[model samples]
Target: MKIIRSKSFTGERAWAALDIANMNGITTRLHWTDQPYKWHTNDGEEVFVVLDGQVQMRYRDLGVEREVLLEVGDIFYASVGTEHVAHPVGAARILVVESEGSV
Candidate 1:
Protein backbone atom coordinates (compact mmCIF):
# COMPACT_ATOMS: atom_id res chain seq x y z
CA MET A 1 0.00 0.00 0.00
CA LYS A 2 1.17 3.50 -0.77
CA ILE A 3 1.13 5.95 2.10
CA ILE A 4 1.21 9.71 1.69
CA ARG A 5 1.67 12.12 4.53
CA SER A 6 0.07 15.31 3.26
CA LYS A 7 1.75 17.60 5.81
CA SER A 8 5.12 16.53 4.46
CA PHE A 9 4.15 16.74 0.82
CA THR A 10 5.58 19.60 -1.18
CA GLY A 11 5.93 20.29 -4.87
CA GLU A 12 8.79 21.73 -6.86
CA ARG A 13 6.63 24.44 -8.34
CA ALA A 14 3.19 25.90 -7.99
CA TRP A 15 0.24 23.70 -9.03
CA ALA A 16 2.36 20.60 -9.07
CA ALA A 17 0.32 17.50 -8.54
CA LEU A 18 0.90 13.95 -7.39
CA ASP A 19 -1.16 11.28 -9.05
CA ILE A 20 -3.06 9.20 -6.56
CA ALA A 21 -5.42 6.99 -8.52
CA ASN A 22 -7.26 6.54 -11.75
CA MET A 23 -10.54 4.72 -12.07
CA ASN A 24 -12.17 4.40 -15.47
CA GLY A 25 -11.65 7.87 -16.95
CA ILE A 26 -11.52 9.65 -13.61
CA THR A 27 -8.44 10.68 -11.66
CA THR A 28 -7.59 11.62 -8.11
CA ARG A 29 -4.67 13.94 -7.46
CA LEU A 30 -3.00 15.81 -4.67
CA HIS A 31 -2.07 19.31 -5.74
CA TRP A 32 0.25 21.85 -4.16
CA THR A 33 -0.03 25.43 -5.24
CA ASP A 34 0.71 28.98 -4.15
CA GLN A 35 -0.65 30.65 -7.24
CA PRO A 36 -3.98 31.12 -8.93
CA TYR A 37 -5.25 29.04 -11.82
CA LYS A 38 -6.84 30.25 -15.02
CA TRP A 39 -10.57 30.37 -15.48
CA HIS A 40 -11.91 27.52 -17.51
CA THR A 41 -14.75 25.07 -17.65
CA ASN A 42 -14.15 21.37 -17.26
CA ASP A 43 -15.14 18.77 -19.79
CA GLY A 44 -16.60 16.78 -16.96
CA GLU A 45 -17.55 17.35 -13.32
CA GLU A 46 -14.96 18.16 -10.67
CA VAL A 47 -14.69 17.59 -6.96
CA PHE A 48 -12.26 19.85 -5.11
CA VAL A 49 -11.28 19.39 -1.51
CA VAL A 50 -9.07 21.54 0.64
CA LEU A 51 -6.61 19.48 2.59
CA ASP A 52 -4.55 22.30 4.08
CA GLY A 53 -4.49 26.09 4.10
CA GLN A 54 -7.11 28.30 2.43
CA VAL A 55 -8.35 28.68 -1.11
CA GLN A 56 -10.60 31.21 -2.75
CA MET A 57 -12.89 29.46 -5.21
CA ARG A 58 -14.33 31.69 -7.86
CA TYR A 59 -17.04 30.76 -10.29
CA ARG A 60 -19.51 32.32 -12.64
CA ASP A 61 -23.20 31.86 -12.16
CA LEU A 62 -25.62 33.16 -14.78
CA GLY A 63 -22.89 35.52 -16.03
CA VAL A 64 -22.25 36.80 -12.50
CA GLU A 65 -19.02 36.14 -10.68
CA ARG A 66 -19.04 34.63 -7.21
CA GLU A 67 -16.43 33.48 -4.74
CA VAL A 68 -16.13 31.51 -1.56
CA LEU A 69 -13.40 30.81 0.97
CA LEU A 70 -12.59 27.14 1.35
CA GLU A 71 -10.79 26.03 4.44
CA VAL A 72 -9.47 22.67 5.50
CA GLY A 73 -11.95 19.86 4.97
CA ASP A 74 -14.09 22.02 2.72
CA ILE A 75 -15.31 20.52 -0.52
CA PHE A 76 -16.41 22.22 -3.70
CA TYR A 77 -18.31 20.48 -6.42
CA ALA A 78 -18.41 21.87 -9.89
CA SER A 79 -20.65 20.56 -12.61
CA VAL A 80 -19.56 20.19 -16.17
CA GLY A 81 -19.17 23.44 -18.10
CA THR A 82 -19.02 25.47 -14.90
CA GLU A 83 -16.53 28.28 -15.37
CA HIS A 84 -14.31 28.54 -12.33
CA VAL A 85 -10.86 29.19 -10.96
CA ALA A 86 -8.95 28.54 -7.78
CA HIS A 87 -6.71 30.96 -5.92
CA PRO A 88 -4.64 29.66 -3.08
CA VAL A 89 -4.15 31.87 -0.02
CA GLY A 90 -0.42 31.72 0.60
CA ALA A 91 0.17 28.02 0.02
CA ALA A 92 -2.33 25.19 -0.17
CA ARG A 93 -2.62 21.48 -0.64
CA ILE A 94 -5.77 20.27 -2.31
CA LEU A 95 -7.31 17.00 -3.38
CA VAL A 96 -9.02 16.93 -6.71
CA VAL A 97 -11.13 14.27 -8.39
CA GLU A 98 -12.09 14.76 -11.99
CA SER A 99 -12.16 13.26 -15.43
CA GLU A 100 -8.79 12.44 -16.91
CA GLY A 101 -7.41 15.07 -19.27
CA SER A 102 -10.05 17.57 -18.17
CA VAL A 103 -9.10 21.22 -18.33
Candidate 2:
Protein backbone atom coordinates (compact mmCIF):
# COMPACT_ATOMS: atom_id res chain seq x y z
CA MET A 1 0.00 0.00 0.00
CA LYS A 2 1.15 3.49 -0.81
CA ILE A 3 0.03 6.73 0.74
CA ILE A 4 0.53 9.59 -1.67
CA ARG A 5 0.26 13.28 -0.92
CA SER A 6 -0.70 14.77 -4.25
CA LYS A 7 -0.23 18.46 -3.31
CA SER A 8 3.42 17.94 -2.43
CA PHE A 9 4.31 15.94 -5.50
CA THR A 10 6.46 17.47 -8.19
CA GLY A 11 7.93 16.27 -11.44
CA GLU A 12 11.39 17.00 -12.71
CA ARG A 13 9.80 18.02 -15.97
CA ALA A 14 6.54 19.47 -17.13
CA TRP A 15 3.48 17.39 -16.27
CA ALA A 16 5.32 15.00 -14.06
CA ALA A 17 3.24 11.94 -13.37
CA LEU A 18 3.31 9.32 -10.66
CA ASP A 19 1.84 5.97 -11.47
CA ILE A 20 -0.95 5.06 -9.15
CA ALA A 21 -2.66 1.89 -10.29
CA ASN A 22 -3.46 -0.39 -13.18
CA MET A 23 -6.50 -2.48 -12.70
CA ASN A 24 -8.16 -4.59 -15.35
CA GLY A 25 -6.14 -2.74 -17.99
CA ILE A 26 -7.13 0.72 -16.69
CA THR A 27 -4.38 2.99 -15.42
CA THR A 28 -4.43 5.75 -12.85
CA ARG A 29 -1.88 8.50 -12.32
CA LEU A 30 -1.21 11.64 -10.35
CA HIS A 31 0.29 14.49 -12.33
CA TRP A 32 2.00 17.74 -11.41
CA THR A 33 2.23 20.52 -13.95
CA ASP A 34 2.61 24.25 -14.31
CA GLN A 35 2.63 24.33 -18.08
CA PRO A 36 0.19 23.63 -20.83
CA TYR A 37 0.01 20.21 -22.39
CA LYS A 38 -0.01 19.68 -26.10
CA TRP A 39 -3.28 19.01 -27.88
CA HIS A 40 -3.91 15.38 -28.53
CA THR A 41 -6.60 12.74 -28.66
CA ASN A 42 -6.83 9.82 -26.31
CA ASP A 43 -7.14 6.42 -27.91
CA GLY A 44 -9.64 5.55 -25.22
CA GLU A 45 -11.76 7.28 -22.60
CA GLU A 46 -10.08 9.53 -20.06
CA VAL A 47 -11.03 10.93 -16.70
CA PHE A 48 -9.24 14.06 -15.52
CA VAL A 49 -9.63 15.17 -11.94
CA VAL A 50 -8.22 18.35 -10.50
CA LEU A 51 -6.93 17.86 -7.00
CA ASP A 52 -5.31 21.22 -6.38
CA GLY A 53 -5.13 24.67 -7.96
CA GLN A 54 -6.97 25.26 -11.26
CA VAL A 55 -6.72 24.45 -14.93
CA GLN A 56 -8.01 25.81 -18.23
CA MET A 57 -9.06 22.80 -20.24
CA ARG A 58 -9.15 23.27 -24.01
CA TYR A 59 -10.90 20.93 -26.38
CA ARG A 60 -12.42 20.67 -29.82
CA ASP A 61 -16.05 19.80 -30.11
CA LEU A 62 -17.55 19.38 -33.55
CA GLY A 63 -14.49 21.18 -34.95
CA VAL A 64 -15.09 24.14 -32.64
CA GLU A 65 -12.40 25.03 -30.12
CA ARG A 66 -13.70 25.47 -26.61
CA GLU A 67 -12.35 25.82 -23.11
CA VAL A 68 -13.47 25.43 -19.55
CA LEU A 69 -12.02 26.30 -16.18
CA LEU A 70 -11.49 23.25 -14.03
CA GLU A 71 -11.17 24.07 -10.36
CA VAL A 72 -10.30 21.88 -7.45
CA GLY A 73 -12.57 18.88 -7.28
CA ASP A 74 -13.68 19.35 -10.88
CA ILE A 75 -13.70 16.30 -13.11
CA PHE A 76 -13.49 16.25 -16.88
CA TYR A 77 -14.33 13.20 -18.88
CA ALA A 78 -12.93 12.88 -22.37
CA SER A 79 -14.48 10.32 -24.60
CA VAL A 80 -12.44 8.51 -27.21
CA GLY A 81 -11.33 10.71 -30.12
CA THR A 82 -11.78 13.88 -28.06
CA GLU A 83 -9.02 16.29 -28.85
CA HIS A 84 -7.97 18.16 -25.76
CA VAL A 85 -5.26 19.98 -23.86
CA ALA A 86 -4.74 21.15 -20.33
CA HIS A 87 -3.34 24.52 -19.25
CA PRO A 88 -2.76 24.87 -15.58
CA VAL A 89 -3.53 28.24 -13.96
CA GLY A 90 -0.46 27.69 -11.81
CA ALA A 91 1.09 24.75 -10.11
CA ALA A 92 -1.60 22.09 -10.17
CA ARG A 93 -2.04 18.50 -9.14
CA ILE A 94 -4.30 16.30 -11.18
CA LEU A 95 -5.45 12.72 -11.11
CA VAL A 96 -5.94 11.01 -14.44
CA VAL A 97 -7.49 7.68 -15.27
CA GLU A 98 -7.35 6.08 -18.68
CA SER A 99 -6.65 2.87 -20.49
CA GLU A 100 -3.17 1.44 -20.25
CA GLY A 101 -0.83 2.81 -22.92
CA SER A 102 -3.35 5.40 -24.10
CA VAL A 103 -2.17 8.79 -25.24
Candidate 3:
Protein backbone atom coordinates (compact mmCIF):
# COMPACT_ATOMS: atom_id res chain seq x y z
CA MET A 1 0.00 0.00 0.00
CA LYS A 2 1.57 3.23 -1.19
CA ILE A 3 0.43 6.78 -0.84
CA ILE A 4 0.98 9.59 -3.34
CA ARG A 5 0.28 13.22 -2.75
CA SER A 6 -1.36 15.50 -5.25
CA LYS A 7 1.37 18.14 -5.07
CA SER A 8 4.00 15.70 -6.32
CA PHE A 9 3.03 16.09 -9.96
CA THR A 10 2.78 19.83 -10.16
CA GLY A 11 4.80 20.46 -13.29
CA GLU A 12 3.13 18.11 -15.73
CA ARG A 13 -0.45 17.58 -16.76
CA ALA A 14 -0.07 13.89 -17.40
CA TRP A 15 -0.67 10.45 -16.00
CA ALA A 16 1.61 9.47 -13.16
CA ALA A 17 1.76 5.70 -13.06
CA LEU A 18 2.01 4.68 -9.44
CA ASP A 19 2.03 0.94 -9.06
CA ILE A 20 2.39 -1.78 -11.66
CA ALA A 21 1.92 -5.50 -11.37
CA ASN A 22 2.31 -7.83 -14.32
CA MET A 23 0.36 -10.59 -12.62
CA ASN A 24 -2.26 -8.22 -11.20
CA GLY A 25 -2.35 -4.81 -12.89
CA ILE A 26 -1.44 -1.12 -12.50
CA THR A 27 -2.61 1.86 -10.52
CA THR A 28 -2.05 5.46 -11.52
CA ARG A 29 -3.34 9.00 -11.27
CA LEU A 30 -3.63 11.84 -13.70
CA HIS A 31 -2.71 15.18 -12.29
CA TRP A 32 -3.79 17.87 -14.63
CA THR A 33 -2.98 21.51 -14.95
CA ASP A 34 -5.08 23.70 -17.21
CA GLN A 35 -4.51 21.46 -20.20
CA PRO A 36 -6.01 18.41 -21.80
CA TYR A 37 -4.55 14.90 -21.72
CA LYS A 38 -5.26 11.60 -23.39
CA TRP A 39 -5.11 8.08 -21.97
CA HIS A 40 -5.69 4.82 -23.79
CA THR A 41 -5.26 1.14 -23.17
CA ASN A 42 -5.02 -1.80 -25.52
CA ASP A 43 -6.44 -4.61 -23.37
CA GLY A 44 -7.25 -3.77 -19.78
CA GLU A 45 -9.84 -2.31 -17.44
CA GLU A 46 -9.49 0.98 -15.60
CA VAL A 47 -11.23 2.71 -12.74
CA PHE A 48 -11.16 6.47 -12.51
CA VAL A 49 -11.64 8.43 -9.34
CA VAL A 50 -11.96 12.15 -9.27
CA LEU A 51 -10.06 13.81 -6.50
CA ASP A 52 -10.65 17.46 -7.17
CA GLY A 53 -12.11 19.92 -9.68
CA GLN A 54 -13.83 18.89 -12.96
CA VAL A 55 -12.85 16.69 -15.90
CA GLN A 56 -14.51 15.68 -19.12
CA MET A 57 -13.97 12.26 -20.66
CA ARG A 58 -14.32 12.01 -24.40
CA TYR A 59 -14.79 8.58 -25.87
CA ARG A 60 -13.70 7.89 -29.41
CA ASP A 61 -15.74 4.77 -30.22
CA LEU A 62 -19.30 5.92 -29.55
CA GLY A 63 -18.41 9.46 -30.57
CA VAL A 64 -19.81 10.67 -27.33
CA GLU A 65 -18.53 12.88 -24.60
CA ARG A 66 -19.23 13.04 -20.89
CA GLU A 67 -18.52 15.98 -18.62
CA VAL A 68 -17.80 14.74 -15.15
CA LEU A 69 -17.84 17.46 -12.53
CA LEU A 70 -16.04 15.49 -9.87
CA GLU A 71 -15.67 16.36 -6.28
CA VAL A 72 -13.45 14.48 -3.87
CA GLY A 73 -15.20 11.15 -3.90
CA ASP A 74 -16.40 10.68 -7.43
CA ILE A 75 -15.42 7.63 -9.45
CA PHE A 76 -15.85 6.20 -12.97
CA TYR A 77 -14.75 3.18 -15.00
CA ALA A 78 -13.53 2.48 -18.51
CA SER A 79 -13.38 -0.81 -20.43
CA VAL A 80 -10.70 -2.24 -22.68
CA GLY A 81 -9.86 -0.81 -26.10
CA THR A 82 -11.64 2.36 -25.20
CA GLU A 83 -9.93 5.43 -26.51
CA HIS A 84 -10.53 8.18 -24.00
CA VAL A 85 -9.27 11.68 -23.42
CA ALA A 86 -9.67 14.07 -20.55
CA HIS A 87 -9.53 17.81 -20.23
CA PRO A 88 -9.46 19.68 -17.04
CA VAL A 89 -11.92 22.49 -16.60
CA GLY A 90 -9.65 23.62 -13.84
CA ALA A 91 -6.92 22.14 -11.69
CA ALA A 92 -8.02 18.55 -11.17
CA ARG A 93 -6.76 15.23 -9.94
CA ILE A 94 -7.90 11.79 -11.09
CA LEU A 95 -6.95 8.37 -9.81
CA VAL A 96 -6.81 5.48 -12.24
CA VAL A 97 -6.87 1.89 -11.11
CA GLU A 98 -6.18 -0.68 -13.81
CA SER A 99 -6.24 -4.45 -13.67
CA GLU A 100 -5.55 -7.37 -16.01
CA GLY A 101 -7.03 -10.87 -16.33
CA SER A 102 -10.64 -11.96 -15.91
CA VAL A 103 -12.98 -9.83 -13.89
Candidate 4:
Protein backbone atom coordinates (compact mmCIF):
# COMPACT_ATOMS: atom_id res chain seq x y z
CA MET A 1 0.00 0.00 0.00
CA LYS A 2 1.19 3.48 -0.82
CA ILE A 3 0.00 7.06 -0.71
CA ILE A 4 1.43 9.69 -3.04
CA ARG A 5 0.87 13.43 -3.20
CA SER A 6 1.05 14.06 -6.90
CA LYS A 7 0.33 17.79 -6.63
CA SER A 8 3.80 18.43 -5.26
CA PHE A 9 6.12 16.63 -7.60
CA THR A 10 9.01 17.50 -9.89
CA GLY A 11 11.64 15.73 -11.92
CA GLU A 12 15.23 16.12 -13.00
CA ARG A 13 14.66 15.98 -16.74
CA ALA A 14 12.08 16.80 -19.35
CA TRP A 15 10.02 13.73 -18.68
CA ALA A 16 10.90 12.37 -15.31
CA ALA A 17 8.53 9.69 -14.12
CA LEU A 18 7.83 8.03 -10.82
CA ASP A 19 6.62 4.47 -11.15
CA ILE A 20 3.49 3.91 -9.15
CA ALA A 21 2.26 0.51 -10.16
CA ASN A 22 2.44 -2.41 -12.57
CA MET A 23 -0.70 -4.41 -12.85
CA ASN A 24 -0.75 -7.33 -15.26
CA GLY A 25 1.63 -6.04 -17.93
CA ILE A 26 0.70 -2.34 -17.77
CA THR A 27 2.67 0.29 -15.93
CA THR A 28 1.23 3.36 -14.23
CA ARG A 29 3.51 6.34 -13.73
CA LEU A 30 3.45 9.95 -12.63
CA HIS A 31 5.54 12.22 -14.82
CA TRP A 32 6.89 15.75 -14.57
CA THR A 33 7.93 17.59 -17.68
CA ASP A 34 8.48 21.07 -19.02
CA GLN A 35 9.72 20.13 -22.46
CA PRO A 36 8.32 18.33 -25.45
CA TYR A 37 8.59 14.61 -25.79
CA LYS A 38 9.90 13.12 -28.99
CA TRP A 39 7.33 12.08 -31.54
CA HIS A 40 6.95 8.34 -31.59
CA THR A 41 4.51 5.50 -31.69
CA ASN A 42 3.79 3.14 -28.84
CA ASP A 43 3.64 -0.56 -29.63
CA GLY A 44 0.63 -0.78 -27.35
CA GLU A 45 -1.93 1.75 -26.15
CA GLU A 46 -1.25 4.77 -23.96
CA VAL A 47 -3.44 6.69 -21.56
CA PHE A 48 -2.22 10.20 -20.78
CA VAL A 49 -3.82 12.23 -18.03
CA VAL A 50 -3.01 15.76 -17.01
CA LEU A 51 -2.75 16.13 -13.29
CA ASP A 52 -1.51 19.71 -13.17
CA GLY A 53 -0.84 22.64 -15.53
CA GLN A 54 -1.46 22.27 -19.29
CA VAL A 55 -0.03 20.47 -22.29
CA GLN A 56 -0.08 20.74 -26.05
CA MET A 57 -0.57 17.26 -27.36
CA ARG A 58 0.61 16.87 -30.95
CA TYR A 59 -0.09 13.93 -33.17
CA ARG A 60 -0.51 12.79 -36.73
CA ASP A 61 -3.72 11.28 -37.92
CA LEU A 62 -3.98 9.87 -41.46
CA GLY A 63 -0.95 11.92 -42.49
CA VAL A 64 -2.44 15.09 -41.08
CA GLU A 65 -0.91 16.68 -38.06
CA ARG A 66 -3.01 18.04 -35.23
CA GLU A 67 -2.69 19.31 -31.71
CA VAL A 68 -4.87 19.66 -28.66
CA LEU A 69 -4.55 21.75 -25.54
CA LEU A 70 -4.93 19.54 -22.54
CA GLU A 71 -5.61 21.13 -19.20
CA VAL A 72 -5.93 19.69 -15.76
CA GLY A 73 -8.22 16.66 -15.57
CA ASP A 74 -8.05 16.14 -19.34
CA ILE A 75 -7.23 12.73 -20.68
CA PHE A 76 -5.76 11.60 -23.99
CA TYR A 77 -5.93 8.07 -25.17
CA ALA A 78 -3.46 7.02 -27.83
CA SER A 79 -4.15 3.70 -29.39
CA VAL A 80 -1.51 1.39 -30.71
CA GLY A 81 0.46 2.79 -33.68
CA THR A 82 -0.66 6.32 -32.91
CA GLU A 83 2.28 8.64 -33.46
CA HIS A 84 2.20 11.36 -30.83
CA VAL A 85 4.18 13.78 -28.70
CA ALA A 86 3.47 15.93 -25.68
CA HIS A 87 4.58 19.50 -25.12
CA PRO A 88 3.92 20.83 -21.69
CA VAL A 89 2.87 24.46 -21.58
CA GLY A 90 5.07 24.91 -18.57
CA ALA A 91 5.82 22.71 -15.61
CA ALA A 92 3.20 19.99 -15.66
CA ARG A 93 2.42 16.79 -13.91
CA ILE A 94 0.97 13.90 -15.88
CA LEU A 95 -0.11 10.41 -15.23
CA VAL A 96 0.61 7.82 -17.90
CA VAL A 97 -0.45 4.26 -18.29
CA GLU A 98 0.97 1.92 -20.90
CA SER A 99 2.60 -1.43 -21.48
CA GLU A 100 5.47 -2.04 -19.11
CA GLY A 101 8.11 -2.29 -21.81
CA SER A 102 6.49 -0.32 -24.61
CA VAL A 103 8.31 2.47 -26.41
* Sort by lDDT, top down from the best: 2, 4, 1, 3
Please give the lDDT score at residue 58 for candidate 3.
66
For residue 6, give model 2's deviation from the true position in Å. 0.8
Q: Tell me model 1's lDDT, rounded to 2 decimals.
A: 0.95
- What's the TM for model 1? 0.97
Model 1, span 1-103: residue lDDT tens: 6898886789999989999999998999999999999999999999999999999999999999999999999999999889999999999999999999997
| Model 4 misplaced stretches (Cα beyond 4 Å) | none
Candidate 1 at residue 71, lDDT? 99
Candidate 3, 1-103: lDDT as tens digits = 5556754645443543444334435645444456777555546777877777677766666766545555667776777777777777777766666664422
Candidate number that wins on TM-score, 1 or 3: 1
Which 10-residue span in candidate 4 carries the lowest summed lDDT?
A: 7-16
The collision pairs in model 1 are: none
What clash pairs does model 3 have?
none
Q: How accurate is candidate 3 locally (lDDT)?
A: 0.61
Itemize residue pairs with steric clashes in candidate 4: none
Candidate closer to the true structure by lDDT (higher is better), 1 or 2: 2
